[model samples]
Target: MNYNTENLDDKRLVALYKKMLLPRLIEEKMLILLRQGKISKWFSGIGQEAIAVGVTMALNDDEYILPMHRNLGIFTTRNIPLNRLFSQWQGKASGFTKGRDRSFHFGSQEHKIVGMISHLGPQLGVADGIALASKLKHKNQVTAVFTGEGGTSEGDFHEALNVASVWQLPVLFCIENNGYGLSTPTKEQYNCEHLADRAVGYGMEAHIIDGNNIIEVYTKVQELAESIRNNPRPVLIEFKTFRMRGHEESSGTDYVPKALFETWETKDPIANFEQFLLTENILSADNIEEIKIKYTKNINDNLELSFNESKIESSEIKELNDVFNIIENEIITHSSEEKEFRFIDAISEGLKQCMERHDDLIIMGQDIAEYGGVFKITEGFLEQFGKERIRNTPICESAIIEVAMGLSIAGMKSVVEMQFADFISSGFNPVVNLLAKSYYRWGQQADVVIRMPCGGGVGAGPFHSQTNEAWFTKTPGLKVVYPAFPYDAKGLLASAVNDPNPVLFFEHKGLYRSIREDVPTDYYTLPLGKASVLKDGTEITVISYGMGLHWVLETLKQYPEISVDVIDLRTLQPLDTETMFNSVKKTGKAIILQEDSLFGSLSSEISALIMENCFEYLDAPVKRVGSLDTPIPFAKALEDQYLGESRFEAALKSLLAY
Candidate 1:
């Protein structure tokens, strides 16, 4: 430890010692609770307390700290009330997540501490977004993220560091190399001696510190933090320490050699740092003992209070609806003097309007910069918004979505473009597991718009042409929007940008240039979850969206005698049941059409919905039309046959005949 006692004043030294002491005491008490079967799981940073506490001390009060499960000590330094922390673990109503999570899975928004993703690596990218936000706002605050040695193996770690380095965002990547990632030793995890060595690959400043020495950890972090806040760049610091306990209380120590465990036990961060304070004459033995007693009493009292609080009942949990808060702006209809726009042009114009309205709206995706997007949806965006708001990201899907979630946490709305909807399969984890569950779990909503260019007919094989809306429609928290006209695309996208929850806005490849409408030159937002009736008739009702709506319209044109009523369900999720049921009840027959595969299709869901609500009004059985179960073939003939208009016409005829 290069830090001298004279460098830190007596008061600062004492504060540092106490900060490290609280987490250690809390960890010891948590183990006791674990044995009594009071807590569900326990992951302690016993010997790594210095890393969490020291970094917390170094960061500015307003700076964000994204902490992993093991870094619970940071909550103490952040001054998050002890009762709230205990209440979370105790599954009580007053916890950050209102008893939704059973462990250290919640973050304090007031304290600028974001809750961690269980898969710790994603938080690194999230921190990158936080840092990006600070830089964008020109705020003098850096973001510090914590992770374990084992976490480096995850791909997001590399992705985050690369993005941070490329942008020169002020981010501090703290890796607590505590010998093992769960049971796997450091030697088995990576070939490098120090995790900091990997930082060079990402063009980040690297530092290695003795994590057991509190003074060393704090002094080094403080020095790096000062530089980061001023110059704004990422710095990776590896804190070498050991975990005193096995992965959890029950994991057993047999996997770790007894001698190895004993050696680290002697070098325990809390006791070692406490002895150093006494040696330096910074604290008396009585003072050190009093501090421990004071914190222990505080923790125990909180534990009691948390246990006495009411558990979150099912009804109470249900009160936290899918989306937390909807920032519903008044609808400003497009005036009569509006201009006509192509579907793709309307999308770009809508985003431009959003960016013009809110400074916090950011656009991110691959090739979305000076090169514009491959489809040129973001053409001229770079010149209009500049690079800070318009980011050209690497082809890393999961990290792109995760980083957007982080920006949303920092009070910014992000619009992420997936080059093709099929490519979203590469980033399914964050979208389905994290992004979808965020609001329901902790009342945190990431105001993000994922723009997916989807559907077949352009002859861009299976990967490029896909209608994946059904996947998100099945998910609980997501809102799926697919517009068939330019006006709907522009208006719905405006609504999606203003929407407080995550929205999957699907733009069909076929309709990008082919569809045109008199879109309002002025800003206008269409109501989400409200179906638009394109035509009204009496014989049969056709329900469709995206490119399929065009097919339904064309098929209706050929059969003018059939008297078909057409409904465009602009939003798949939160589907407009009233309009759909009313139309079906009037016609007494329904034909559901979609571009996705027939098995488990969106049409299948609507079929079930119709049977459940409008069965009595039906004069004929409902029919569904869609592509074959096979993957979208590259051959134009086969692809045309797969989604041929004849198939759609046949389904409509069959339903009408029955």
Candidate 2:
């Protein structure tokens, strides 16, 4: 169906035409910069301006927008300073991320615009979480998320739509069907007829529209945004358009067919809108030319201003020290009496206390609501905090993690639970790529803790029983915490909740009920990177964490004569080098133990550290002990053999003899 410009009032028609022209001109200028080598890269929204500008203009000023990399028109429509946009492209300190990120990789909290990631699909789930927050607060605001036709095929796209539909969230999923995903056409990308048809499977409202028509995009998006704001439901609108240029400046359009490219050139949204304005007499040709000249001048002036902005100073390039934002000296809670608390209860209590203390704290996991989680770690939380705070999400790990990142960006402290640490592989992309990089790149506080029930020994086998702390330990900008006792579990969890960076809190399932400790009755916090010397010895030093620490302690009972100094590395990322080095320096011998595979494990990292720091002090070569190099066995006998006390006993004897 053709969208008539006559349907819009004169003022609205003029405004839409100008909005379409502004970004087109800016992109044209950016192309010149790209050729001149003034800009590093450019992703143009040349022919698809109407879709981004129309939807952005239709939404309320306070409403949130999650724009993809190509949605440059959103920046113009939202009035993001053109100079700042240019500064980001130029990698100047004046940019939103202080020269840390380029392109649409940086978000503006002041403008209520969340930036996009290259992965593209994860942000859709994050937008769902933002919409969920708005709905819970009764803000009557709608979050509009932009993605391409290719993004619809992603697993996260399916996860986001399913959750939004299940919860009836206030979300506007604006998909720009630009005919191609980078270089592949829609026919080769998906089997579906229209991308909008896939939304029906999720029980979401779906529509298809002529993306070149400004009036159609604006009117339809405006009406749908209003409906979702009032009714709180997700609607998917697919705008059919084409990208006139290649994916980026460096990626040439040699892959495109000549006839197809020529066809889209005539259908340029800006030119089509301009022609409509002139034919309808809503805007005179001279007046439209003046608008074009004005925008051209505006773009050039902003480019000059951005070039003048100061470069990032060397002094400003500080280390990533805020990985764990902890309050050191403050006694959060003081009590003389101690109560015996189980490890699982301590974890639940830490979450409860954090939620009660901070109104912004939220918990999300599968079966966490009425079912209280598969392991009952969140039992009775649904009744206490209500469903709004304790959300039971679908078993989509990527979506769950991405949603948590969104909540964190919105200044909410989120705690996500993985039923088994092994399942973290499903959510690995968002955690390692987005959550770990947020703080270092843009200084955004990823105030989130992913509770991972890890370690083997349970008959659950490989898929469920596994220690994955080593994966995160190797990653920068993330803190890895594993507490062997209930005291550390409760205190460290409280600290993880308060930390401004993302934390992976590993809780060994075997230690959940097998051990108990005298936990402080009142709320308190422990330092994230601090290590506790559980036992002091002069002969040998054994460094371990989680269930591995427990095995070390138990193994020492058989050898009563061995004075082994057992150190629990509560936090793995910032390994307590001082404590471990000092112990090894005193003992002149070291042993590392982990529940992960022996090769390339956390023990390997610790052994390397020992070699580097205490080479001269060591009387013998350091030893490492861990599970066998294979997937956890399903059979009880093989599993025990794979992870048994004999392994630690043998390693300790070898180290002692050496």
lDDT of 1 by residue, 361-404 (tens): 99999999998898898899899999988899988888888889
Per-residue accuracy of model 2 over 1-658 as CA lDDT, tens digit each: 2556556678887888788788888888888878889988888888899898899889999998999988888888889999988998887877877677799998888888988878989899889888877887789989999899888889989998998899898888989999888888888999988989988788888999889878889998888888878789999999999998898867778888999999988888888777766777778889978888888889989999998888766453354553434345344764887888889888888889888988988899989999998889899999999998999989899988988888886677889999888899999999998898877666676888999998888888879998888889888888899999999999888888887789999999998888988888888988878999988989999999888888888888888898878999999977889999999999999988888888878888889989999999999999988888999998989999898456888778988998
Task: For each candidate, give its TM-score against the true structure.
Answer: 0.97, 0.96
Model 1 segments more than 4 A misplaced = 1-3, 314-317, 320-322
Candidate 1 structure, TM-score to reference: 0.97
Model 2 residue 299 lDDT score:
91
**Candidates' lDDT values, in order?**
0.86, 0.86
Candidate 1: global Cα-lDDT? 0.86
Span of 10 residues, lowest total lDDT, candidate 1:
316-325
